[model samples]
Target: MLSNTIFNTIQKISFIKRTKFYNFCKEIIFPFIVTNISKLFKDDIDEKLIVMGAFGGGAFVDNSKYLFEFLNERSDYKLVWIAKLNHVAEVIRKKGYKVVSTYSLKAIKLLRSAKFIFMTHGHMDLLPIRFSPKTTKILTFHGTPIKRVDFNIKEAFMYNGWGDYFRLKLKNNQYIDYVLTHSGNKIEHDVLSKQLLISSKKILPLGYPRNDILLCKEKEFTEELKKKYNISEGIERIILYAPTFRSNLIVKFEISKQELNRLNKLLNELNSLFLIKGHMVSEKIDFNDQKSIKLLDKSADIQELLIISDLLITDYSSVQLDFLLTLKPVILFPYDYDEYYRTKGLNYDLEEIAGGPIVYTTEDLIDTIRNIDNIDYKFKEKRIMLRERFNKYVDDKSTERVLDFFNIKYRA
Candidate 1:
């Protein structure tokens, strides 16, 4: 705990990242150590072996999780999940899946010998490791980009200086062999290629594995979710409010008890349950004993929640694009639009991409929810158009397509 506190304190010092000593350690010393350590292992790539991880192996969620599930069901391939946290490993173990600790000797051996290593965030998902040149590293990015990412964002380049940026770029190019996207559109391809520092050819528009569940109607999963959340059968609707992470770590919402009570009353009157799922990095909003309002687990698989939701309320999140596939009602609540735009930046203006009502205040948000039926009807065409622009594939066969692309045969 003391060591962790010290590390956290050092990380909070902004100038440390810009120091010459830090750059030497991060860009030079770290890679050198990883490379030398990796050399100790043989480059024996197992064609049937695939290792996967996400969110630095702290949680099992995202495109990698779905892909892991698909492969786990098959008999031909040897699948393993690399978990950095013991609890995460235990959870995967409870599901009767093979999971190894990221720092374990078994994990290092698996990573070095695996033919394919799949990740959602980055290579760090299986941190402090290096892969064989014969191994293929595939990045199934967490979401469709609505905000700037990686080196594409100005802050990333300016924060660490050009030398550090180039070093990071070189590392990314060396590590990631391929990246997956939801669509084949030129703009999408270009954005990913630029942000990820990889060639356009390496960006495969094979669709996202997580979106597969969203396209298909999973009644069993819905029932499972209902039981897990203890949601009653009498509930008419489930409205999910998921907001993207803010750089400042502030939640720009009315979280006062009075306001929460009012929102809860509105949800109760509509026979609906309002759920708030904040981004992993975002500040948590206190629901404050409101019976109709619930705060979802931060590490929950949101794709499953999206499956059971009647409506989605979000602000500047790529989740809006995923929810559009459901052809359901969405309410955009960008209360801090100007401030967010200035600090974090967005790829496209909200008005240009929003397929539903855009409300700015708590009162407006409540009013919009009250009249959601009409709003849903009004945005039908717009939603379809936006969905097509964002997601090219609308079927539940993305996992199959991914397997086919990789030529991984599964028994029927």
Candidate 2:
């Protein structure tokens, strides 16, 4: 695997350049087109709900796809999705929805005229999009309890580079409205915004419609996943090792050539196979020839993986919060806990928020695994507790709650 520091540096350069280029187009071409679209599409503004899945990857993919399925038969909202990615746009188009390629000044105008807009989620990149303050925006917050970055008097005085991002982008909570809840964490509703300095009345504790797939344990789906990996019918357990990206990037991930060697050896010895999955930003790992330990190459479908997965070992990927509905065992591997807490920050401390086991070292991880050797006994109680707490309703009809929140009546 390539070093994360080098990868992140390259990505940051590419990100900055991309942001500048897009913002320039937004400022120049978008206004002219949006103005015209408003006149041309005045007749259609109330006919369709234009949703910008501008985040344009797995996160938005999960939300948009599920919403599309729910609104498939409804004629109230035409339900147009704007996509920037070719592959994902193709996926959405395949589902019979018209996709505006993305960022055409004309398209922005059309989006502005829509009756409502779903801001897929929190994205700082949107700081540039020109739309009227009157546009109805729904910010679906996947994680609402995100810990705020508190600047110290001393740190602010130093004028550090690390403080600059928080200084400019965050400093306030007035950017978004209407917190769409996935886990239904009521604690977020009571907490007041620091920047807004007033209570937000738009926090809706509705369940995410996308995660409905996780609740389904169909024999056909489970069998297909096992067959895909050539895992025999029921020989061993399926453990998912999904880790989020480390903001610090370097210290959070200490790749010991020795540890990789040890992990390869341990995989050969272990009974339950571990599928190593990197976060969206994490550098991909390539294993020479290992069956028990494998790395995900380019499979976009995570819902299927979640279905076959029996025990999940994740680190703050929000998938931990997503998978909480199933009551699966999640193990947090915060090797860079101090660095992450100091820098990236968490909405809630893992000790309080994470409803599962946490391991800080290799030996401790192994010991935790042994202690929970019996799959049925290990997570039975915790899973049930998580299920009732996180999920208000775990059924095919979670779309109902989402529609109730949006006031979009479900037709089918």
Candidate 3:
């Protein structure tokens, strides 16, 4: 099996090397042909509207939509449009904003005219995307950056999909105009502003602005989503298993199967709703569901679900920490934990970080749930220690605070 696995690895690299290298180079070379060196910051910071040269998948897409709308209503510095995918770009376009694709010729042209370039916890690394300092790049790091993301460089450089498309395995030393982060918690060890090292002017904390909606009750939205997906009623409890992908050592885009009978069997036994929101780069799993257990490809409204979910099952996912802010239960299912930790890595120990149960097998996870009521004393202790540090706001002004820091001046 080991020999066959080695041969398969070689075969996969050989196949990707055959055609994708040239295509990948095309994407890298696109920067030169994009907007000229001087054009990135040319339009005098068009306050009438801001232009974000965006990337990444859903998190970025979702947050940008809200930001775009907020900016349009209150200030002249709206993110007028984005060079992004349809889900977010389309909605903003519908709001009378332009939504263009990023990296392609069309994207490049959009950036040429763009006065402000921004990325929000998205996948599009600004290293290759950086054309000029005048462009004014704003990076709103979605989650706290984990300590170890790259597992094997040699193995990664040899592949296509697993490397650059997901993690920014490359190093970027460029200084951003502003880094709008979920502050209140120290990004570095500084925890607060005065002891900072990086440009103190740019390290503005805005609480987690996007989680505003997540903190609310979107029952209608949930019902609509459930109805649209034809999800059956009688779901007593909803649990989201969001696992963060480790780098090359952790195969993010792995092939998975629909455990139809297994899933149903478990659902019948446990009587709960389970959602497998695979990491952004993770491969798809299609298990057409009847009533019991349903595996989703991905859902755009994850924050909404996060609000409704009773418990969260995760593995090295920052979402677990995010969910903790809601004062809920979280469980771990680190199936490839050792391999993931050795290869890619974590900021801190998972056991140390989580305030909840660390369970692996399905039975173990179910058992944790069964005994969830009694676990609050331990979780609350961690929450009390970490809450003030991580969350600055006990209310709904995170987005407003962020926009204010950007000097965008949008209304609440």
Candidate 4:
């Protein structure tokens, strides 16, 4: 109880002030804990079971979604998920599965016992599972790279900040067994290898399992989602606007009333429904009063929404890569391009690879949407080239390839 209170108080202190304290913990406290962990807990590790954690259990819609479903169907293995919030655990429980709290003793035992541990993100919540000595760690990686990642910059990662104490010194990813990747793009694969500090041999070029759903023609699912979202009878098409999560920039771009009015008018003229999905970390803007636009929260399934969207609008987001699998039109809205480039450092040129018109403002966005039919055809070849370069195995057999690596026979 006292330790928790002290840690909470320390967290409230500014990051700069708390650096020395975390460094002390890393140098002195960590070794003592690691050496004595066996004395604190007594349980034989279970090799058959696989344990997984992601985004602190806010949503189960990433790589874990497919892996969980796969493991759940196989009665031979036990799958345990660790969530920070009880409500998040409850949602998983209702899915006919088991979930343990991040701070629970059960989670500790599972972490110590599990043979395989998979994490989608490398945040602090995953520390316990990630550091487990016996487990074979695999990261499905949350998204395709757009901005320069932590591991890519050695000075920023290892020397410049206190973040290195947590990300590198304590949870050293050197022990990672494998990291997933998509094939055909040598540049992307090389960048991922360098970013992870893992050998290229350990990086599997298996296509992302999450993208497999986009390749299917789920007419019934699409109809059901439309009904669930309350789309009007006359809506001809749906345009999905999903932006990538930015660490430094939290506030999303807001539209003025005039711009909103114009957007609504254009949607009416195009006979389209505009669905806006903000980054998971973003606060929802009040668009409830707007009749033509539907605001989707973090809980919404982005893949399902992408399936129904006729066009996609984004800025520096990897969702553009995922949407390309559908051979649909996309518009790049880099309103803060200079600011973003300075801070996050994009790997590729936005205009060069956008596969459609790269708009700098909301006015350009509206204009592009108004003339999308011609724009789609104009960028058709570019989109195909980008798709071939990034996605080598478009046949949707990525999940099977991953399972095959572990010698797990997939019956399907």
Best by lDDT: 1
Q: Residues 91-171, candidate 1: write the lDDT tens digits.
A: 999989999876556777888899988999886687546677788888998776777676243443343454354343334
Candidate 3 lDDT (Cα, 0 to 1): 0.55
For model 3, the stretches where C-alpha displacement exceeds 4 angstroms are 1-28, 35-44, 57-62, 73-78, 84-96, 103-115, 121-135, 150-172, 187-201, 217-233, 246-266, 269-271, 281-286
Give model 1 RMSD, 1 decimal.
3.6
Query: Can you write out model 4's per-residue Cα lDDT over 35-135, one digit (the tens) per residue?
Result: 34524665466767888877744567678777877778764678888776555677889999877766555666777777877777643334433345566
The number of clashing residue pairs in model 4 is 0
Candidate 3 has a TM-score of 0.75
Clashes of each: 0, 5, 4, 0
Candidate 3 per-residue lDDT, tens place, 143-165, comes to 55444433332332444354345
Error of 4 at 160 (Å): 8.6
lDDT of 1 at 253: 57
Off by over 4 Å in 2: 1-44, 54-60, 73-76, 123-135, 144-177, 183-185, 191-199, 225-235, 248-258, 268-271, 374-383, 394-396
Give lDDT for model 2.
Answer: 0.57
Candidate 1 structure lDDT:
0.79
lDDT score of residue 359 within candidate 4:
86
Point out the higher-scoring one by TM-score: 1 or 4: 1
